[model samples]
Target: MTDQLDDLIATVQEQERRLVLTRFTHDDAWALGSLVVGLARERGLPVTVDVTRGAQQLFHAALEGTAAHNDVWIARKVATVRELGTSSFLAGLQARARGEVFEDAPWIDATRMAGHGGAFPITVEGAGVVGTLTVSGLPQADDHALAVEALELFRAG
Candidate 1:
């Protein structure tokens, strides 16, 4: 997995022509969040992404809207916290990969729609967390897949 991660990082750096292949950071999280959200929208998922504050703060407003299933949302957390919340959500999903579970800690209605999402921690070899890549607006499975795709792109650069 670490090798795969390294490959991913290299890919992203090569393609983006940037030097973020270090540890993932808040800035990366913001970029990842924004990119995935925009991609989702382009894919007709009707989503939004903002890595300004914590993930909760970023999506708090959008969740209030009247979007139906396939509606996407994203947010970047503080520098230290970064995408911690979103990462936890992704870990939980990975833990329960076999089935779907309804989670209420953040007070989200998981079953209302496909109700699933994921956040990836982008980090450089020694730079620490550069950012996060998160995606929502599709079934949990699809969301995870999309997130991976985005990460792959980021690394392929």
Candidate 2:
């Protein structure tokens, strides 16, 4: 389990290093959000997608079968990304690798932050992580994958 966790951490770190945006704007957020929404629709996924730049929420959508609680999850996951400057998934994996629970960390407030997968940093080339892209309502890994897939597609286009 430790080795697997370490491998996963490496993969997530590589993803964070590779999936960077040149710049993030309100229009870019809409485009990225639309891509995520379309991907979810194609897969018949019930999820909520959110994009934020710093403290500003640029785009948000709740798909079919998703509940309001998904937004709460989004908030917590986004907080994780904001605090860690990495994918929320990576934060969880790092904690596991250290034999610690993420929420048990002294600096984390469980109510406002979560290390669950789903939130990814929206990193710009020069500005570092300017925002976050998040999804919720599926299993943590799946939610993280969905966000990563959308980002890959958006980056490719």
The digit string of per-residue lDDT tens for model 1 on 1-157 reads 6565455444533423332364345555556566666566576664333343223333311222226332333332122125232342443443344343434434433332122444444555655554444454455446556666666665665
Best by TM-score: 2
lDDT of 2 by residue, 1-157 (tens): 8788878888888999999989899999999999999999999999999999999999999999999999999999999988879888888888888888999999899999998999999999989999999999999999999999989999999
**C-alpha lDDT of residue 102 in model 1:** 31
Clashing pairs in model 2? none
What is the model-wide C-alpha lDDT for candidate 1?
0.44
Candidate 2 least-lDDT 10 residues: 1-10
Clash number for candidate 2: 0
TM-score of 1: 0.46
Per-residue lDDT of 32 in model 1 = 59
**What is the TM-score of each predicted model, taking all chains together?**
0.46, 0.97
**Could you tell me which 10 consecutive residues in candidate 1 have the lowest summed lDDT?**
72-81
Task: State each model's CA lDDT, in order.
Answer: 0.44, 0.93
